[model samples]
Target: MARYVTGAPPPSLDPAVVALLEKAETATIGHWRHWGFVDRRVAPLLPRRRVAGTAFTVMLPANDGTMLAHALDHLRPGDVLVVDRLGDRRHACIGGGLAVAAQAAGAVAAVVDGPCTDLEEIEEAGFPVWCRGLAPVTTQIFDMGGAMNVPVSIGGAVVMPGDAVICDNSGVLVLPPGEAEAEARRAIETQARGAETARRVAAGELRMGVVSGATARVTGG
Candidate 1:
């Protein structure tokens, strides 16, 4: 029932990985597709808790327990289960059982760009799942999907196996491998600058001078 390969590297490096991290500040998964991450139309089928973990991608069409079981065994703590259903929201490829298995193996959460079932069961397990839709139908184990340890596309963005995935109430964001340090630093600095501006605003800092330049920088005016 395995559809893809795991442990094997991707054919080539994704050119978009670099730019994806560059635009990390504004990248979000919502209305627009191909922002800075994959557009897995996933809803939290399990729980509404926050999810932060390294991504382990699975490609559908050639995947099954043989591959998933191995992937689970190999995955370390702080990992997120990323499954690419090839944009197919027809059936529930993953559900509660898989969530339980993944959690037992130390998975932080799961992200599926396809349909998912067993919402109640998953929620009870306290596993965070972001999926496209909900359904009881599952794949026929046709070896169509596989567990690939390479970069795979879900929604519209490419997710490398080791990238960091952060999901919250706002939306989901993917950070390319090794880019977390720099991105986090920049985000912190920008947030500090914003906080300072907020303080000034409370102290009567008007748009005449203080806020005008900042506005221009953000708006290109």
Candidate 2:
């Protein structure tokens, strides 16, 4: 196999769609969706801000970060670097320098299937990252085999280059391009309705169970 295999980067997503998707919280989308969620293990460093972007998938071999470094150059504005660690969890591929590079290149966030280093740097850089966790050990520029712009696995989710990515405090959600707009629109509407329901409940005008049909179910039972 070639030491480094790369494919054409996926087309950038529409800014309008990304904006719409960003407004939809992952938690709200989770209510109606059961699939496409990244594994719970891949947690975020900065979870307060929500972001939506296109998936820029990369797969790396153990102890190698050559492809990742190269991938940074290819990142477009609003791209989310989706790293497939290929089962190596200890070697960190992302750090302070890469964070800045990605930021300058217009990457909104990253999702790593493994650990990363330089927690303090990442925090100071204000770069958002989601990964297995942190590690002291890191990857070197080994010319090990790797792939870019291809379908890769991250935290139990199948992510393809150019797939829609919705990330928030709750977690990361990947969806096919065709489903992003409709699903995001649904989530936004649901959240709006949920707010009104909460408002009524808070005003003592309604009960939680009643709004959710739980009261009727229990009463009939």
Q: Pick the TM-score winner.
A: 2
What candidate 2 gets wrong by more than 4 Å, as runs, is none
On residues 1-221, what C-alpha lDDT tens digit does candidate 1 reach at each position?
32456575322223344333333343222323345455535555534545566778877752333455456676656677888776566767677888788899887778888877888888788878888868877765454446557777876777887777766544567766576556645654665676787787788875535465776777677
C-alpha lDDT of all candidate models, in order = 0.64, 0.92
The clash count of every prediction, one per candidate, is 25, 0
Give TM-scores for every candidate, taking all chains together and pairing residue i with residue i: 0.72, 0.97
Evaluate residue 5 in candidate 2 and report its C-alpha lDDT on the 0 to 100 scale. Answer: 79
lDDT of 2 by residue, 138-164 (tens): 999878889999999988899989999
Report the lDDT of model 2 for residue 151: 93
